[model samples]
Target: MLDQQITRSIRKMIEAREERVRNGDANGYGVDFFGMLLQSPVNSNISLQDIVDECKTFYFAGHVSSSALLTWTVVLLAMHPEWQERARKEVIQVLGSDTPSFDGLAQLKIVR
Candidate 1:
C-alpha cells in the first residue's frame, strides 16, 4: 500500500544518511542539526529509525514555531518603530557590528 511504500522510502533515506555519517562523509550535510541529536548520550542507544522520527518531529515543530515567531516579530517591529530603533541601538552597542553572537544574543533583553 501507499503507507508501506512511504515508510520504506523514509527508512531508506535515514539509512542512507546513517551510512554517510558512518563513512565520514560530512560534505553537503547539515551537521549542526545532526550534531544536536548526536551530542546527547542517550541517543547513542537509540535506533536509527527512532532518531529519524525524533529529528523529523523536531524539524517540523521548529520550522512551524520559528516561522510564527519571525512573522510576529517583523509585524511588531513594523508597528513600533521606536521600539525597533531601541533594539537596533542595543544590538549595535552590545555587538559593535551587525553580527550577533551567542553572548550578544543573551544580552538582547529588549527583544525578550
Candidate 2:
C-alpha cells in the first residue's frame, strides 16, 4: 500500500538522478539531501536497495513526530538486556553483517 508507493517514488527519484548523470547534468539536482544520498565516494559499492532504504528513512522520519516513541523504545530496550541480546543474535543470524533488506527484516522474527 503506502510502502509500495514510497518505494516507487524513491525508484523514480533514483532513475532521474541516474539519467542526469548519464546526460552530464549531475549538478542539476543541486546539493540537497536527495543529491547527497545519491552520490557515493570513490570505489563505494552502494546498491539500489541501499539508496531506497536511505530515502525511505529520510521520508518517514521527516513526516513523523517520533522523538517520544524513539526515546521510549530506547528506554525499553535498555531495561531489557536479555531482549537486546536476543535481538542482536537474531539479526546476526538472519543478516550476518549485511545491511538489512525488506525480506531479511521479515525473517528476523525476534527482532520484529
**Clash number for each model:** 0, 0
| C-alpha lDDT score of every prediction, in listed order | 0.67, 0.76
The positional error of residue 66 in candidate 1, measured at the CA in angstroms, is 0.6
Local error of candidate 1 at residue 68 (angstroms)? 0.9
C-alpha lDDT (0 to 100) for residue 17 of candidate 2: 83
Tens digits of lDDT, candidate 1, 7-106: 5766776667657867889543343555444433343566656656766666657888888999999999999999999998887788896444344577
For candidate 2, the TM-score is 0.49
Query: Considering summed lDDT, which 10 consecutive residues are worst modelled in model 2?
Result: 35-44
